[model samples]
Target: MACNITKLPLFRSISSRSFASAANPKPIGGVCDYEVENSTVNGVLVTSAENNSPITRVSIVYRAGSRQESSDNQGVSHVLRLCAGLTTKSASQFMITRNIQQVGASLHCTLDRETISYTLEGTRKAVEQVLPFLSTVATEHTFRPWEVADIVGRLRLELATRPPQFRTVDLLHKAAYRTGLGNSLFIAKYNIGKIGPETLQHFVNCNLTADKATVVGLGVDHKELTYIVEKIKFPELAGQPINPSPYKGGEIRCDKGGDLAYVAIAGEGAGHNNMKEAAACAVLQKIFGTGSSVPYALDHGMLRSSIKVTDSFAISGLNANYADTGLVGAMFVAPSNVAGQITENVVDILKNGKVTDEWVSKGKNQLKAAVLLASENGKSVVRKLGQTGALTGSGISPNQYINLVESVSTQDVNNVLQKLGRNLSISSFGNLTCVPYLADLK
Candidate 1:
């Protein structure tokens, strides 16, 4: 969403329109600055911001997310995500862990359907002290067979503990795209132990390349970041060509019996390629409702406002953007007996919801707060900003994001709302006896 990039001395301005090859394959647009200056270094895209904060973070983001997985290598991304601290060519799992903890730094591996990011954060001097370890952990994965097998239990634990809402959204992606972006972030049970060391290595060799990655840093110098980035020996090419995954709507229902129903429905949304439209979708999500930001606070969201039943139910709008296409809609949780009605109400509102000037104004305010609050998590901001520069040719400053939000008018929001239910995808999980089918709804 947004990142705070405070000014630091000795930060020279470098002029750049966009990344060289960072967007080479599977490029998702939405090229705006993360309040960081962008530059291209040796074949890699580097984006960094200077700050006075003692904490510093640097992340190497590869385009190798779940979307990169093919039929033969499903769930490799999840396994790879868990394999972060495992043995690398340069260091053992024990040493990697020991060294990072020793420096009071944290190493994390996170992945979405689109990108997998490896981040190292600590005090500025501490990060500088172990900078090479970041590259070693990210690029030099050996994926020893024994080491890979040991983490299967961790995968199982993850799957078993996921909440219903997570499963519903994961299923929603499948119903929406059926492939590519539809791939699950979790490893399917069948693919559990089948993905061997070779499969892991093959996938990385083919999809994760230096040219297709972006380096992002916070509280760090551009020259220092660029210099280190050039030395990270990322995979040099000869991998699978990343393809654009378009949205194709459909429906899926998993009758996983339970007392409540988890349902998610969405329609085609604006992709990042169109800045105004994308920003509008962000605002539109807020307009419809994203529930209360205050924990344990009453939710008076627009989606909740229209519901007649007072039964325990939860609702929130969804807005997900990618390079080529996106999905916009809502998810609901309620007693199975009333699930259908709540879902119908959500769809009714989505398809016929009116976007007024006042609603749009409120949405802008909510969107601004959401972006700014998200930026508060320094690590998350760096991760989201990983590939922005590569996707779009250039960027705008922090103040300009407010300008972008302001640029979205009521008409633009309504334009997005009108697309709802056009090519809709509905995913329902849990006790689905009362959940309506896509055709059953008006």
Candidate 2:
């Protein structure tokens, strides 16, 4: 029986409430609630959000990701990410871990195609205790050869456990952009030993510059963070700017032995600068749905429902926004024999898909809910603030962002769908005979 929650919040309660009244009601992101400040400490950019929480999150985000790496230095960024919190010039790896644990703080590193971040989360006092340590981790690192060797072994194991779908998206980027954004986040097995400490150091010296890095703090005082940031010195970005690589539509296939095939079909969509289009693409993603929200079930989205059988298959929408370009499409995983049928159906739906007012409204509401929920998490807010600063030099409130999503009409979604199909790029792995080619998609 369907529960009637007409009067409750669409997301918080199990309701079939109409979103027309709620749509564009107010700005929902709430990032603007905090007093945001931006300053340059000795050439390093610092963006802070004084959220007034006892706990604080400090992140050092740099533009030195895979996109900055060249053919010779491939996988250097991955190695650098592993080296975070390791031995620095003034501290040993053991000492670093012990100190953070003693202070009851959490420290970790995260990387994407365009950026790498090292974050520390704890009480304000604990964060203060580790600011200098984080600075060392971000800049004054001593990449010893033995430590680099150890990290390489761990990276190989990490790469091995990833599902074939993850590798497929990596290949999709390679086919879409060829290089730059095309570079894979996971290092190739052969490049493991090849990425030495010297190469990592060179990559750091050239990319981790004061100009390319941002120190972002959430739930911390702006003045205090600025004072701490002023004392740390970082190398300048001495490398020449990387040339822009446009999206070159194509396909890449790997015949890894497996019973199921993993496929991702995509084309250029919206860049980060075009947030309206990005938001529209996100609504499309939610409308298409990604697999199932419930365990042992499948979504009723167009692609999922169109499939006659699914015990052997899984498919989802793929929408990713980047600094200058984006990818919008679908991913499919199915038994080798049935993969072709599933892929064909999904592509057909995407090419000629129709978006209704109901789907658009639901998608906007869901996207708004996700943005609000992420804001409730301190770490997520920190990352959001950092990304805003890095990309747009400012932040938007959750409420404002919600309105952006709410404003996406069915027409916007249809336009984005048409754009995605205009120039398709297909990436397939595992069993090959069942996945469709770019020509087949056309």
Candidate 3:
């Protein structure tokens, strides 16, 4: 449900919905109808937040991410992201860059496992002058063979420079879901330059349509965004489907044989529909610990056993929520000699330990603070706005965000923790001599 919502207004019914909609037909003049407003303009999804800040961010978010790729079109998303701002059907790369930079507006692209965004950022007036570029870069792609070939080097550079931890997490997804959500964010080494123009076009035709797209704005008026979205007349196709990502917990190890080891162990968690459970899983991650809040100081809150290692070891709870399902557990970096001991100990605590009220309270506070901080930051706020709107169909306000954190209870936290580690998915990189296998850990 990306943006084809019709009939019902998509904006959250915050205050008196009937009164607000009737009294305030405009987007910004007095009191906000809602902190975040969600609506549909001519069958296209629009989500936005109005603020007094000078900076404005507008993104055309499409549900076509790496997960949207098919077996034949694997790694097409990676190629597609690099192809952004290239010679689109409407404008050349030089024209797009020069116009955006002339107005001090920045046009950029970002991708995650589930979505891709082409965003424009600058002052309101400046952004308005260059807003057309955003839509052009996002929706219109010429994908000339030569231009597409130029990005091959960039793709190689990205994969070659990835850190060990990143590689480990990539493998972890492969072990967890096996496909769909498990698809690698980076292109496969063998497939470089293999994803040609035809495949990229095909992938977009299937998944980058209006039914799978969301128009998101921050510090910009909703009406202004609505007008822009309506004018663009986004492309749409009916009945697009994706491979399901079901949790099939297992082990994936990358035996790189380094002195240091990177490990991520996880189990099934909540999904997008289970908001409360997702919040509870977040709390459980916090209670187990999210690393040290203080710079240079190690976290002594959760995974307390890691503290006694005497050698350097970093451990933080992992919680990820996706459209269908999620994964939750811990990820750590430690000396290869001690990786097995630390892994077993962390597993023991997550599966057998009982969380106290004090830890739960602390987790709530930390989680709330994080939410507030993200809500306030200009860059993070818009990204969150775009991501949530694109994925959930409705956006969340800062207040609603904090309230979600506050609503989780001690029982909820404990219940979520108790369900983890049932069938662990483990991914690690480094010396295999000492690091234990999933069979060994189980």
Candidate 4:
């Protein structure tokens, strides 16, 4: 649960009022500020907030990511994100890293399908000291030639050793959308090797821009943070807004090598703002994959599986909620021969939505219990808040989301299952021999 942001000591004694001023007034956007400041940094919306503590956490979020790239530039956002952590023209990465460490501060960046973020955390004093460096890395990193070579070498090694991690998701996306922004994760090995300094530079210049960025600083003084934000500038980018082309979901199949077959079945679900439908989908997924205590035979039996749970093969249900789209998926690693049987069994469980009141009640109770556990940590709280704000442009407390989950009825779960049955996308990775069994599911 350790996030990309750092923790510093200087924030032990600050008050929210430290940032209340005319120069940095409340934001004008609708429902944009949630214990934070919402402003436009070079035409990109930014959010900042203050806690009683003296620490300030700054995060720069952008809408650019793997989903924004063309087929030829599959991993461009990921490469660019790593490059953002490297040395800039005005300073060495080591010197800046050491300086921030001296003040008990840290910085990190993460790239996902829809967004990339840069986070900085430290005490007020350390944050103030490191803000300019953060700004420089954010807007002025040169992506030097030697550094690009070094990163590319490392990336190649990673791809070679860990191709499955990238390939699994990449293939899943391709399976879902045959063409458009979603189906372009696989860039040929030759193309990956050919990514040069110029390629990285062009990627950074074209994809990263103020128009698609959001800056969020939490637990800080708004006036001071606004002043710091105002000083940061980047060259204006001229182009049409990056609109992800529409996707029409379909099946995708591929073969690699392994004794067991790995399968992922997904379907379109509600977005973050569709609270009711989203909650229903969550309950539906839990009923199908949630652990035994629910009185569901399938979940109880799966929990009782004699197969030794390897650290890598822990089975779980996944619900990924995006701004515009969401995915509800279940993954299982089973013997190659039984892979088809498992998929069919799972699909049958989803189609035959038979949940008693006890099962529904238990699922709700389980979800509520987990939320209570997550609230004890400051980092989890901050992350949950940030993610909700980023996705929905609104804030919902943990209790609120739990309430929604608890309110989902058996009828709701059945409705979601019926909806899912109509639209399904499945992906299998392993030996080609296992693929025949999986392909028979449709």
> Which one wins on TM-score?
3
- Please give the ranking of all candidate structures by TM-score, highest first, separated by commas: 3, 1, 2, 4
Per-residue alpha-carbon lDDT of model 1 for 351-420, expressed as tens digits? 7888889889999999888777666666656765774554553333455677899899888989888886
lDDT, candidate 1, equals 0.77
TM-score of each: 0.90, 0.87, 0.91, 0.78
Model 3 C-alpha RMSD vs. true structure (Å) is 6.6
Candidate 2 TM-score versus the reference: 0.87
lDDT of 4 by residue, 84-143 (tens): 657775667676666668788888776666666777776656666666667767666587
Task: Please identify model 1 stretches exceeding 4 Å from their true place.
Answer: 1-35, 294-296, 393-397
Candidate 2 residue lDDT tens string, 296-360:
87576656777786466677878988777799988978889888887787777767778888888
The candidate 2 region of ten consecutive residues with least summed lDDT is 1-10
lDDT of 2 at 119: 80
Each candidate's number of clashing pairs is: 2, 10, 0, 3
Could you tell which candidate, 1 or 3, scores higher by TM-score? 3
Residue 216 lDDT (model 3): 89
Taking the tens digit of each residue's C-alpha lDDT, what string does model 3 give over 1-442?
1111001011111232111122222332222224899998766679988755667778888877888777887899888888888888777778876777777778778888888888777766667667777777777777899999998888888888888878888888999988898899888989998999998888888888888888988777787678668767567665268668789988887788769999898889997778899999988888778877899876876885444677778888888888878888888899988888888887777677778788899999999887776666766776777777777888788788778989999998888777875777888887756778788764
Alpha-carbon RMSD to native, per candidate? 7.3, 10.3, 6.6, 6.5
Collision pairs in model 3? none
| TM-score of structure candidate 4 | 0.78
